[model samples]
Target: MSEVKKIATRDSYGNALVELGKEHDDVVVLDADLAAATKTGTFKKAFPERHIDCGIAECDMMGIAAGIATTGRVPFASSFAMFAAGRAFEQVRNSIGYPHLNVKIGATHAGISVGEDGATHQCNEDIALMRTIPGMVVINPSDDVEAKAAVKAAYEHNGPVYLRFGRLAAPVINDRPDYKFELGKGVILREGKDLTIIATGLMVSEALEAAETLAAGGIEAKVINIHTIKPLDEELVVTAARETGKVVTVEEHSVIGGLGSAVCDALCAKAPVPVLKIGVQDVFGESGPAVKLLEKYGLTAAGICKSVKEWY
Candidate 1:
């Protein structure tokens, strides 16, 4: 098996947001006083005037962000994923989505990746809820390059954008800026013809590893990096199924409404392949290390390998 390369997406967002702030003066940052934790500290340090520390009020922060965006400024609101989705969901939906404001929601500490913070802090159903909002663009970038591109894309694309990042470092799976992020396109990380593993966020790297593991077991699994969850890659999902008879969708999200459901909807409605959804099987996270949570919930590469091995 190949060694997993881990890099937190929160840091990627923070660094890329600074780059964005440097590129454009209109790029503003709104944090719920969690600058360093959410990796928005770099932006705050670089552009003090553009940083709005809302002092722990996630609801107010979302509203403030919407108001800022209404003034023709690009506001990237930062907070823990739990507060961003669970605490301020109504504010986010009404202020950002209903009004169709140009706000970029940079949700940090996503999934079971929030190792020690426990179930209360971790957000597995966040993406599913965010995706339900009409005109909302939900993105889960798998690497630094995608993080940067997603930042720019959210800024350029005139609508509400929700981007989730994790606390724990995951693999920097994406190697090139060779591709630009289309609002609804899923990128192919690895191509194969036996079974397909459609994945998003940190799971993309794991799915790739799982594919390799399956190959050694005489199974060739295709891997799709589903960075965009809302406006899913219908073409790629159908295409992957056509190429491979079986599908295994992975994410650090809920098994029900997250990437798994999205892929299954596409595959069942169109391609109609045998799909196995791997994720937090409809349960909240526990107070433990990320590796332990991943292992407990079967989100790790070894777990993915086991799932594919069963089918093979």
Candidate 2:
């Protein structure tokens, strides 16, 4: 087999922004003094006129992005997850979400995988916060290909959107030419009859790896990649719940209001199957290496496999 590719989703978001800027003149990029870290510097280098650095004021960036959106320009406000989703939440709600403006929030360094940045910098609740906005479309892409496609889709979409990105260099799982990304649709990566493993963001690849381990023990597991957290593919989730009778949700975010909660919510009213949530258990993050943090937080492939087995 060929060597697997590994790239950060934030890098993919930056490259996608550059490509979008080249194709659309109305595309504008804004960052809160984190151009290099958030990777919006790529767009700034490619299209300096369209990219704007808003200093360290994340709330001000949201307001400026909203103002630019009012003029019919597609503005992507890039910032760390803590600043974008936590600090500027009010601006995002009133300025963009309430008015239904065309603004895309590229939130990078999300979740505990932000590592040594510690608890304050590592935002594990961005998905929950974004999902609360009425008109905001929440998207958490699994890999580079999905992240690129999600950026284009968000641009084509004509409303408020929150694109969650990660800093860790995760494995490129959707590198196949046949992979196509559609907003609000879950991709079934592997099929099985015993149980279903639903995952998003960096945890999607981990779920795939766990599925392989489970298969070796004569436990066939289905893996579903839920890139879109809001406007969730309810049909697929309900079908999987009913077919498998057991569901497991894995994510790099908090299990409280992230993918796991969303999955349980979808199934609670419909299929009502036994669901196990595999993520941070409503706890704050700590300083550690990305890989070590994942293992400690029960976000590894082995951890996922163990959780599934225990719940099974």
Candidate 3:
């Protein structure tokens, strides 16, 4: 196996925002002090006049973005996931979500992959918090290419959008010469009949690798990448469940209310099957190397393969 190039999704979000600024003058960016960390600094450097620094106030930033959206201008508000989604929960729920404003919340440093930040900074519940709000489009792209495409999609779509990005560099799985992204649709990367592996965000690549290992063990596993989490592609999920008769969900978030729970909710309503959720087991992350944390939490390809073996 050859080495694959890796890039953080936050980098893609920043570059994409800059491109959007060049194309659409109405596009504006706002950051709550951590522009460089969130990678919104790339857009700020390109469009200083359009960029607004809201200081360290995450709630104020959300409100300002909501206000900006009312004037028919698109605002991309960025901050760490813990502050943006967790701290500004009330403001986001009322100010932006209630009105369904055209504000894009670019939440960086999501999941336990935020090394050295520990549980205080690592956010594993942003998806659960954001998805609970009505009319909010939730997207967690898997890699650099998908992240860039997701930024463009969020800008085009009206209403509130929560774009979850991570700090760790992820393998470029969707780096195809001709790769197109469709909103609210799940892409089937590999087809199999024994079981289905549905994953979102960084877990997509892990799921793919797990599929390869499972194939070696004579267990054919279908791999599906679900970037859009809120309005999940029910048809594809149901079809996969119906065909495979067994399912496994993988995510970088907690197993409670993230992708795993969302998959179970969809499957339980339509096709009942034995489902396994692979993610943070309802525990806070501690300070450690990101790779080691993933391995400890059983979020790697080997861990996924082990879970499959146990299930079978």
Model 3 ranges with Cα > 4 A deviation:
none
Q: How close is candidate 3 to the true structure, as a TM-score?
A: 0.99
TM-score per candidate, chains pooled: 0.96, 0.99, 0.99
Provide the clash count, candidate 2. Answer: 0
lDDT of each model, Cα atoms only? 0.88, 0.95, 0.94
Candidate 1 residue-wise lDDT, 220-291, digit = tens: 878889898988989988988888888888999999889888888888889998888888888888899888
lDDT of 2 by residue, 1-312 (tens): 998899999999999999999899999999999999999999999999999999999999999999999899999999999999999999999999999999999999999999999999999999999999998899999899999999999999999999999999989999898998999999999999999999999999999999999999999999999999999999999999899889999999998888988888889998999889999998999999989999998899999988888878
Candidate 1, residue 249: how far the Cα is off, in Å: 0.4
Task: Report residue 32 deviation for candidate 1 (angstroms).
Answer: 0.5
